[model samples]
Target: MSKARDFILDIFMPTRCPCCEGFIKWDKLLCEECERALEPVDNSNEVPPAGCSAAVSAFKYDGAAKQGIYALKDGWGISFAVYTAPLLAEKLKGCGADLITCVPMAKRKANERGYNQAEVIAKELSKLMGIPYDGGLLTRRTTSMAQHDLETASERAEFAKTLYGIADGHSDITGKKLLLADDIHTTGATLSECAGRLLSMGASDIIAVTLCRTVKEK
Candidate 1:
């Protein structure tokens, strides 16, 4: 399908709010109420993932924020990135990031879904931040356990090492700060693995930025 034709078709179709199913503008993913209900994570202090120097999230993965990310990941088309990019870009001010990249989806899964929401979000953010968005910095070699499917975080940690493979031609990462973006951060296993892989390639630092993050339950 041509992107031009898809864009035209999307314009005629009514985009519904992910939560309420009410009509919304093509660029809007959530209605006013759903949008207002989300709370930004207090990213004032750098919350680094286990293997990375710093990390941040735009919203806590609860209520509307969770629903919005789900819609972006599964329910809607690529347009959801249009709505989510600004939410992350506005929060990234002053973070000295040299380049931008995103967690990679398996080739089969990405083909089945037709798009990777994380890469889309990252590219949109790159456009806003004026940083490079390299969709090929990392590739998913194996489809590992969904973090939520695991009984504990330890199990998630054990499976992380086999999940990703670094790409070639990325050796320029040596001593450069990198911003890794994703749609959500649950146990941080995925982000941690990707960050460590880049670090091994001589990247100096990694600042992971997720659009949503799951708050641990007591």
Candidate 2:
């Protein structure tokens, strides 16, 4: 039934590559050219966010990966999340996460975008990894400036400190190992802030994962 439904959807709305916006085979995530252009990251030596036990990211935030993330953020290509989740899941194998959650957006911002892309990715990841997903595990405080608007890592980190809070019904995460998902990791400020909040709520540990991470210049 699922395959049949997908076939029908593909017939009417052919799946396009999120990065290039070019037609792609229904089962493919990216056009061959775009896939070839992506730079896979080696995050083995990367440090985790301040309060996270570990962290992993699939691709560097450039070229194809950046475009795909923008498409999902703008609500144009949500399948980007579906396709990217598997890559993150593979990297996160043996992470020991009991529950999966995402870096939340403010209600107003989420309503404006129609959905939170991070949540979409986290939910898909939960299905693939056989972990439970809790969409409301955290909430973002309304803010005047978006994280990207902050220029420096220090500025982003300071702004992020007041950005997140534990959701009302999820205050007690005692002993639960969490997987925190996000679309991008630039300076690690936001993920660190979110992980700190979870840890304060008694979460035993957190593993952070993102679809893309900004590559530092060599």
Please state every model's RMSD to the true fold in angstroms: 2.9, 1.7
lDDT of candidate 2 at residue 126, scale 0 to 100: 87
- Tell me the lDDT of candidate 1: 0.77
Model 2: lDDT to the true structure: 0.87
Model 1: CA > 4 A from native: 1-12, 75-80
Q: How far is candidate 2 from the true structure (C-alpha RMSD, Å)?
A: 1.7
Residue-pair clashes per candidate = 0, 0
Taking the tens digit of each residue's C-alpha lDDT, what string does model 1 give over 100-205? 9899888777776777888888888899999987777888874645556777777987777777888876547788888898888877888899998998888899
- lDDT tens readout by residue for model 2, 1-218: 27778778889999899999999887777788987888888988778889987889888899988999999998877877776788889988887889999999998988989999888889899889999998777889897788888899999999998888878876457899999999998889999999998888889999888988887888
Number of the predicted model whose TM-score against the real structure is largest = 2
Off by over 4 Å in 2: none
Residue 75 in candidate 1 has what lDDT? 38
- Residue pairs with clashing backbones, model 1: none
- State each model's CA lDDT, in order: 0.77, 0.87
